[model samples]
Target: MVKVKNLTDKEYLYGHKACPGCGLGTIGRLALKILGERTIVALPASCMSTVTTQYPQMNYSVPSLTMAFAGTGAVLTGMSAGLKAQGITDVHVLGLAGDGGTADIGLQALSGAVERGDDFIYICYDNEAYMNTGVQRSSLTPIGANTTNSPSGTASYGEKKPKKNLFEIMIAHRIPYAATASSAYPYDFMNKMEKAKSIRGPRFIHIMCPCPTGWGFASDLTVEIGKLAVETGMWYLAEYENGKVRMNVISKTLKPVEEYLIKQRRFRHLTEDTIKLIREHRDSEWRIIRERWVLSKC
Candidate 1:
């Protein structure tokens, strides 16, 4: 068994409200481990909100503000501003949400937060669909993937659009730091989290989390499925700073995209043509990201 490194944070102890194998919960547990007691969390309505704010009590070790489904960035920005006005700069503020909360409904507040260079580390744990709300398709959902709203049948080509390019959107804001990570690898994920907080301006972290409930995979396969996402180039590990692109993993020998697809029942309806189409789209997108965009150290 892989032993995850320990964290100094001691807030999380016994009781918590995450479903068994809830990837988001693991992410929160790990993140707060580094963010520690000195941090405050601003969360939008998502799986995290549900888990942390489970009816009888809550799970956040530090102070937290639960904002509307799409207002985490705005709320966090305002909170940070209020704290700044009060000369409370020692506490680190973090705004976090799901992919639906980040890529779609919450984009406006998120964009504004980044553009204004709010002093917070905003994270989106991208489960790709709105899992807490009946597994509907979100802008972050992969093309050709079936969601409750995009089920395969006589209608539509199954989420007709590509996954929204959130990284590009963050880049457009010229934010100080932004990176994409995977939950299956905590070392890389936590390292990025720590690094992002060190910067003075806004920082964005987009983490891919596998959802067994929504993705139609067995819960036990969460880690393996997440790993397959990277091995197949379906999801990649990338980072950006000072306006340049740096990809962390581009497998020398890519695991077939088909292996990754067949694991999830969501893509089970695929015919050979649909599979080919999906791979073609995936590669085309990868081609653009494969280039190393230079950054100015200024």
Candidate 2:
């Protein structure tokens, strides 16, 4: 681990209300550590909001403004404008929201913020679903994965579609930067945050944070599962910067998706055929992304 001359004390103090082994809380703490006290986080209605609530003593040491479930992106933009108008350009601005908040309900506001080139970082601590909302399925949920709303029992299918191409979408907007990060790799996450802070226009980081309660795995396995997702190629480490796509974390050795999925009760009912389909989907997606990235480089 690289040593920082001045790493801020954990802005999110101990004795918080997050569930045991909640990767989000731990990673959130690490993120704030990197951002220091000068950063202003615009949070939304998610599990994170609870951590920042008045009752929790607002774990966020720096000032935090809570927004509606779907207004994080817009609110961050407004905050940036207000601060810049006051000639206060030193503080780092961040919008921290969950996958459900970022990928589904808050998407339009997110897109608007990026398109307007808002000078801030929007970081989605993606736990794959609306964990705060009883584990309902969200667009960030992987295909063939089960959720309370996207049950395997089927109104139709288990997360029938693939995780939305959020990085690509950000590319479509030609934002200055967009990338993915995982709690399993704190340094990577922190590095992305630092990079985004230096950039002028809109920047986004999709951070994978595991939910022990919702994923039906042992609380201690949160970090393991997150690392496994990347190893299995189910989640690719990628980024889009200045309209160019690149794979940031390339998994030279692929692990079986089954290794990643079988431990979770959510995928307990997945049949061999379904598992195979998921494997194929992941491989094909990886190929598509890699090919495009390579050609673009050429």
Judge candidate 2 at residue 194 and give its lDDT: 70
- TM-score for each candidate, following the candidate numbering: 0.93, 0.93
lDDT of 2 by residue, 1-298 (tens): 3256556655554556878888877666877776777888888999888755757376766788888999988998898899899999888887889998998999999999888887888888988899887889899998876788788884544788889977777778888998887898777777777777678888988888988888889988988998898889777676676667667654466788999999898888888888999989988987887677742110
Q: What are the C-alpha RMSDs, in order, of all predicted structures?
A: 3.2, 2.6
**Taking the tens digit of each residue's C-alpha lDDT, what string does model 1 give over 160-233?**
67788898889888888988888987778888888886788789999999988888888899999999998897
Q: In candidate 2, residue 242 scores what lDDT?
A: 64
Candidate 1: clashing pairs of residues:
none
Best by lDDT: 1
Query: Backbone clashes in each candidate structure, one number apiece?
Result: 0, 0
